[model samples]
Target: MTTVPPFQRALEAHGDAVWRYLRGMVGAGAADDCFQETFLAALRAYPRLHRESNLRAWLLTIAHRKAIDHLRRRRRDALEPLGEEIEAKPQGDGAIWSAVATLPPRQRAAVLLRYGGDLAHREIAAAIGCSEEAARRSLHEGLKRLRETL
Candidate 1:
């Protein structure tokens, strides 16, 4: 049987990536709460998980759902810039992220999982809960929109 890492170890290893994904998904404003909710949900389900493979993808899947739920609660189809009061971002990144925030939900999640989370297309598909072809399409559509907007 495959050995699963302790839950804390998985958290330590993947926390930053998950947080960044959440930040990119829901924006910095709600990332912390989303992050907490993601991990809490993951922790609850971890013991039932059968394999250690693709733990990052599994965590990201939870994060994606949490982000979607958060967005739904706010009653928005697209994310919006939280303005200058938000946390510091790298130079010239604001415009791109602003454009990213305007993408449709699946497109945005696919883009963030691929680029922001640095996950492969297969993993992104798993995270976004779609077929690989769908994830690729979403990524393609999202990048196309960003290019057109920026």
Candidate 2:
């Protein structure tokens, strides 16, 4: 069997999507911190990861945890997330993203995973620690809310 590279290689390969997912999760300002924590946590747990594990889903799962931690810390500070959200947009997608950013956290994560990270519902379910049906429902609700808002 061919051997795969380790966490460093995985980080280089999937960093952009993970960063974007974290940005969508907690906004740009906090994304870097969460991104770093995700890899750090992943580093600690890397040795235990199975060879067949989906690295993208695994990284996103770690990112999700880091995001939750960041949100909790932000809550302790009494700060709003989207209040200081992404200062940059992907050109012509600003309105759509604004609507997306207003979505409830679970819905937002669902949307981001489905579209931003290009993850299947099953992978998203794994990343978010939910049932596949729940991931689908969250995506549906998030899209409905986005349509309504936009």
Candidate 3:
């Protein structure tokens, strides 16, 4: 049977990638909270996992879900009548990432997983819960859109 590595090892190995992915998905404002939620949920589920295969992808899947949740909450919060909040725009690489944030959810995720997380198409398929072909298409469409946007 395949053995699972210690959770700490997985955290050490993948934390940055997951954080970057979250930042790409939800913006820096919400990325930290989403990152924490991802790892917290992963910590809860890690023991139930039977094998250690693709821990990075697994963590990314959790991160993706957390990002989605944060985005939804942000959308909901935006609809409420709260005082105007001015968030500082990110600079440098953030400019490209801001364009990335404009893509549809699946496409954004596909781009982030491929470029930011450095995950293979198959790993991205697993992370985003789609077929490999679908993942590839999403990545393609996202990149194509980005090319036009930039």
Candidate 4:
């Protein structure tokens, strides 16, 4: 067995990162609810989880699905600007991140998983339920678009 951390410890370890990921996806206004939903769902399903599971990736996978569901329910943009409204300036932080919001859904998820979730390509593939090549393509194209927008 890979000796995953207990759920409480996993929450303590991953809570902040998961919240930030949610915030990056849905904006801070709804992030708290989404965060709770993620954990609630995770807790309900935790017992049946495989012992060899990658907990953080699994949690993030749940977060990704929850975010997508949240987006579909609300029909909102996948990502909001990071801090404040970004004027269309090339060098602004908000502008850069805001660009991320403009990507198509798959690309946006790929970008957020790579940068926001700090996940590797393989992990991102696993989390997003895509093949590694598709994940790589999304990440690559997403970054290219962000750069162009910035």
lDDT of each: 0.83, 0.83, 0.83, 0.79
Q: Give the least accurate 10-residue stretch of model 2, judged by summed lDDT.
A: 83-92
Compose the digit string of candidate 2's lDDT tens values, residues 44-131.
8888787888888888888887887887888899876573465354546667766777888899899988887889999999888899
lDDT of 3 by residue, 1-150 (tens): 566888999899999999889877887766788888999999999988878468888889889888877778778877521111112453676557767877898999999999889999999998889999999999999999999988
Which parts of model 2 have CA positions greater than 4 angstroms off? 1-4, 87-92
lDDT of 1 by residue, 8-39 (tens): 99999899889878877777778899999999
119 Cα displacement, candidate 3 (Å): 1.7
RMSD in angstroms, all models?
Answer: 3.1, 2.2, 3.3, 4.2
Candidate 3 segments exceeding 4 Å error: 1-3, 79-87
Q: Which is the leading candidate under TM-score?
A: 2
- Screening candidate 3 with a backbone cut-off below 3 angstroms (N, C-alpha, C), the clashing residue pairs are none
Higher-ranked by lDDT: 2 or 4 = 2
Off by over 4 Å in 4: 1-4, 76-92
Error of 1 at 149 (Å): 1.9
**lDDT (tens digit, per residue) of candidate 4 on 1-150:** 554457898799888778867766766667788999999999989878888877888889999999889878766554544334223324436665566657777888888888878899999999889899999999999999888887
